[model samples]
Target: MGKKLLVLGASGNTGQHLVKQALERDHHVTALVRDPAKIEIKHDKLSVEKCDVFNKEEMRPHLENAEVVLSCLGFPLQRKEPVPYYLQVAQVLSETMHEFGKRRVVFMHSWYTHPESRARCRGFFLKNFFLPYVIGQSLNGMRLSEEYLDSTDHLDYTCIQPAHLLDGPVTDKKFILNETDSCIADAAQEINRADVARYMLDVIDDESSYRKIRAIGVGVDVTDKAILTDDNHSYVPNCPIRISRADVARYMLDVIDDEGSYRKIRAMGIEGDDSYMAVIMEQIDEFKKVIFRN
Candidate 1:
C-alpha cells in the first residue's frame, strides 16, 4: 500500500529527511535534484533525477503517476537567491502537475512569512534588525511562493510554514498546524528540521489537510512537571536558579563543557517582557560570575 512520491529540493537539509522518511514509510520516492550526487540515497524504491526545477517540460516526465509532491525548497537565512525564483518554481510545478494530472502538493515555507507571525515576533533586536534585514529578503520569496501556490488550480496544495528551525534529531516534540494568520508558536518557538519533515509527511495521506495553508509549531503539547524523588525530600539548591529550559538547553551537550564557555554567559533574552523568551541574560551572567570567577 505504498504511494509514489516526487520530492523537489531533495539535496537540502529538510528535503533529505523527507526523502529518507518517505522511503522508510515504503513509498516509491523520486527525488529531483540539481545534483544527483547530493541525494546520496540508494534504494530500489527510490529514483533520483537531475533537472532544473524551473523547467516544467523537464520535470513533467518525473511527475508521471506521482501520487504526492513535496517541495522543501528555499535558501538559507544568511543568503538570498535570485529574484522570484520561489515564485518561478511554484509556477513551473503547478503547470507541470496539472498537465500530468497530479494534484497533491506540499510547499515548504516559514511562519515568519506570515505578516501576523512576523508582527508578533517579540524581541526588538529580532524584529527591527535581525528579521527585517538579515532574514527578511529570503522570507519575502517564501511569501511569494505561497501566493503562487494559492493561485494554482486543480491542486490539493498544503503550504507548510515551520517555526524557527533548530538542528537536532527527530524529536518526540509534538507539532501542531494552525490555519490562521497568527504565528504558529510564540516568538521563542524553535522546531527541529526532522520534525518539520515528519509533519509534512503526516499530512500527505491526510485528505483533511488538502487545500490548507498552515503554520507549524513544535513542542506545543509539551508540559513541564517536577519529577519526585523516592525520599519525601525535595532537593532544593542554595539559590533558586530560574532559567528558561530553552536557554539552559542552548548550553547543553558539548556547549556547556566547551572551554569557550567556561567563564562566559551566552546572553539570550531580556526580562520583564511579554515574550515567551524570559530574562536569561542576568541569570547566566550571575552563574558564570559566581562559579567561574577568579
Candidate 2:
C-alpha cells in the first residue's frame, strides 16, 4: 500500500534522489525542508513544506497522518560542540512523531557508527589528525538519535547505515547486514547515495523493514555459493536483528568484495596499529559465533 511519507532533509545529495524516486512511484510525498525557495522537485504528487527541524512545533504539522518518515538530515562535519544538535533534532522528531501518531521512522547513519563493522576507510592522515572530530560529532549525534529510536518503544523504526557514502554512481550488488557483530566484517565496502535512497524507499514501501536499525554497504554482483545464481541478497551486518536469509546472502556477497575490511580484521587487535583500519574495525566481536556458526 502506498502511504504518505515525509523526508526531513529534502534538499541534499541523497535526499533529492529520494524525493524524485518517491514521486515517480506515485506515493504521497512531502518534502520537508528548512528553505521553501529551494524546492526543486517537479511532480504534482510532491508537496514541499518549509520548517526548521530544530523546532518541535514547527515540524509536527508536517507529520500529519504520515505513515513513514525519512530523515536525510544534512548535518555538517565541523562543529565545536555537536551532541546538542544531534539530540535536539532527534528530540524534535520524537516529539513530532508522538504528536502526529506516526509509527515509523527510517534514518541514516555512517558505517563506523555501528561499533562493529569496518566497511570503509579514512587513510592515515585523515583518521589520526582530522576525521575523528567529525566522526566523533556524528557518533555523538547518532547516539542520541539511536537512543530516541530505542526509547520510543511505540514506533516502528529502522535506522539505515551506509558505508562510506561516496558521490559516485550506484552499483547493484549485495547489502551487508551484521546479525551478531562479535567482530567487524573482513572486507571492504562502499555505497552510492542513489543506492541508499533506493534502499530507503524499498524499506518504506514494505513493512518488513520496520522497527530495525540497519547498516547498509554496497557490494559488487557476485555468486553466492550457498544460493543458486538467480537470486538477489539482502544481508546487512552491523545492523540489529530481524532480517532474512536472502538478505544474509546478499550481505555475505558485499563482504566478499570488501578488501579494505579484510585487512583490518587481521590488524584489529594490534596495539601500535593506527592505520585507520585498526581503529575503524574497532567494534568488539560479540556476535562472531552466531553470525558464522549458522
Candidate No. with top TM-score: 1
The 0-to-1 C-alpha lDDT of every candidate, in the order given, reads: 0.72, 0.62
Best by lDDT: 1
Superposed model 1: Cα runs more than 4 Å off: 76-83, 186-188, 220-294
lDDT of 2 at 17: 79
The TM-score between candidate 2 and the true structure equals 0.67
lDDT of the structure predicted as candidate 2? 0.62
**Candidate 2 per-residue C-alpha lDDT over 1-294 given as tens digits, one digit per residue, 9 for 90 to 100:** 567988878888888878877876778888888787777767777889887888777776777757788888856543354445656776777777877677878887665554333233434433443334445556657756776677876678777877656676655655666433311243234578888888888887567677666766654443333321211223222222222334455655656877744643221111122333333344223122222333
Residue 42's lDDT in candidate 1 = 89
Q: What's the C-alpha lDDT at position 120 in model 2?
A: 39
TM for candidate 1 is 0.73
lDDT of 1 by residue, 86-142 (tens): 778888878888887888999888777765568878656566655665566567777
> Candidate 2: where is the Cα deviation over 4 Å?
79-82, 115-127, 179-188, 205-208, 221-294
